[model samples]
Target: MKKRGSGILCHITSLPSPFGIGDFGAGAYEFADFLSEAKQSYWQILPLNPTNKRYFDSPFSSLSSCAGNTALISPQLLAAEGLLTQMEVEDHPHFPERRVDYPAVSRFKRQLFQRAHIRFQKGGVPEDYARFCRGNSMWLEDHALFTAISDHLGNLPLAEWPQELSNRSSEKVQLLREELWDEVEREKFLQYLFFKQWHLLKNYCNGKGIRIIGEFPMFMNYDAVDIWANPELFKVDEQKKPYLLAGSPADAFSAEGQLFNCAVYDWDGLRRNGFNWWIRRFHYLFRQYDFVRIDHFQGLTSCWEVPVGEQNGLRGNWQKVPTQEFFNTMLQHYPLFPVIAEDLGTIGADVRETMARYAIPGMKVILFGFQKEARERSYLPHLHPLNSVAYTGTHDTDTVTGWYQGAGDEERLELYRYLGRRVENGVNWELIRLALMSVAHTAVIQMQDVLGAGEESRMNRPGKAEGNWEWRIPTADLGEVASRLSEMTACYGRAQD
Candidate 1:
């Protein structure tokens, strides 16, 4: 992280695979090999948490902060472990090649997991599974039980469940635990497979000198296991419903501001407990990633809190938090904290001061540099600070080619003038070259940008809820892309060799 390097921003779900979605399978290994051949020092990915498809299927809005996504469990790996037969592995529906069919993938994987679980039950569980369960009992047990109960009750939110179950009173919890013990174990088995496969893939990448940059959202969804398991830690009413919601003030991206629909934290309660929960969370994430990117780092200094019933974030107020104390406590526990601050939105002096004091690298996006205002020059590569991570565009942004296509004539001309050229090469690669050659310590480009993809391959749209996080790369283009990226890495002195 201290050296000048570059990487690609591609989520695990974006990896090419024969299954409906990507997994910790051959696609993952092939990507690692491609990165190695390209001399890439890092492979940045979104959060690996299990996404709630019933929600928006956004990685940030996950069911559990600690649990891995079972959708990423490799069926081939399962066959290798003798839990699934070759025929079973080969017998799957024909999924779309360019996009993920989440619902279909969920159904297919769930049935396969059931078969694997039955086989494991008959053959006796492995000692490794027992050790993993014991080691992660702190969060795993509660998450497994919560998932089992949610399934049993037909996926109802905890608040809608029976009062005794919702409150998780000792007697009700014990009774349900006994009744749903098998279901809980089944959930645990799924997580065990996920981690087992993930570790193997991570080891493969690390062996190739590729470090993973994992994402961590600042706030938790109201329906997540974290809030459900620890209701006392959030701004909830007597009945455990949220009193205030998390969001941002009106910005260029949204006239009414973004309604995140996440629960605001009870800062006082968390401070009273010495922020041990966050400390544990960081411990888990650091073990899983070489560098953790704290999404919405500005929220740590202050947050925009809106009334729970508000239609939008226009009526929200900014409240300062105990940012310094929280970070200090976290550092006391884990001194060598390697983190990147996603300081993208409106930031105050205090936030900048905190990040500077901690020496944490902030972010610069080239897509934001073409604004009509001169004050926005910081996003330009020439103005980027040395201790920052630069990107052509983030997953939340349109692909470079897409942005160029959608831009007005004036904006396109301005972009060309800024680059001191007029479409000499593809806009995507031109922007990528700018990022790689910048003074920032690290540069990352989205996979779509590297492939010169257009709007059809866009990963997300900020205001839109559906039709996002579905983009996937085609397997046939990896070789050519790797060769081009390797040349670029060497030209910019970012090559590892």
Candidate 2:
């Protein structure tokens, strides 16, 4: 990140695929090749953590932070590895080309996964599979048990389960584990497949000089395995329900406030435990990716804690944590903490100080630069600091063209004035150019913006519940701008070799 470089922000789910959702398959390698051709140095993606349909499959709200979304396991890759037959891989529904049908995809993949598991069982487990299970046992065993029990009980929440299992009584758990041995092993097998395919793709990207930048969400879903397995690490009540939820305090965004319904961390308990959970989580993430973006970075210093059952975010209070001690411990574990801070929202001075002290790069989304209150000069291209990562917009924001289309006259005039010229090359390209030319050492653009895609191509809408995270790129459109992007990258001194 020290040298001038540029990357694209496209999640795995957004990549083109015939499996209804992107995965670690041929399309991923093709995207890597495209990135290399376009002179990109980084391939940033959202959290690959396991997602559940209950939360509309949001990546941020995951079943296990240490686990990968099995839905991303490519059937094609499985067939190539001889686990799935070629005919079985090709036999599928007519999936939507531009959007993911999560439920449909889930149903389809579950069958394929079962078949693969059965085939593997018939052939006997390989040494590598055994090694993967053993190496990831810390989280793998508990997660598998949690998943197996949930399935056995018809997807009931942990709190609603029988007391013996819910409380994780060692005797009852061991008994249940024996009973659900097949189910537990199936879950572990799925993880093995997800990791095997993922590392292969990561290696391909690295071999092409493209570094993978993954994300780590600050909070965990209340129903996640982490909360159920490690109750002491969270602020859960007697019923195992979260006493406080994670969210933002009432401000300009909402008068009442927001409730994320996510579990809040027990900061004191974490510190007492030497932040072992967090250190392990980082170790898990760093092993797969070159860099990791710490989402909701301000939470490291202080978080807005809203009491559970609150109708709105009004009752939330800022709770501070041992920021210095936490990072100190993290540094002790990792001598080089390669992280990008998602300092997008209302961040405090303490958070900023910690980021600066640790030399962690913060984000500079150009979309926010034109907003009324956020028209800070630092957000402008000419004023971006060298230590920040510049972007046309993030996954949560609209595409560059979408924002430009909806911009008020005043905002448009302001943007034009900042550019000091007319909009000749499309607005998306103009912003992309701005990002590339900015003093920021790293510039990351959304794939949507690269094709001048509009609102329909936006990856996500923050407050809206559904119809988001469904956008996908077409294979043909990927190479359309390679030459132009490569030219601009070289012109801006961002091209590698």
| lDDT tens per residue, model 2, 88-144 | 999999999999999999999999999999999999879999999889999999999
Clashing pairs in 1: none
- How would you encode candidate 1's per-residue C-alpha lDDT over 177-228 as one tens digit per residue? 9999889988999999888898889899999999999997788878778887
Candidate 2: the clashing residue pairs are none
Model 2 is weakest, by summed lDDT over 10 consecutive residues, at 249-258
Runs of candidate 2 exceeding 4 Å displacement:
250-256
Q: Estimate the TM-score for candidate 1.
A: 0.97
- lDDT at 404, model 1: 81
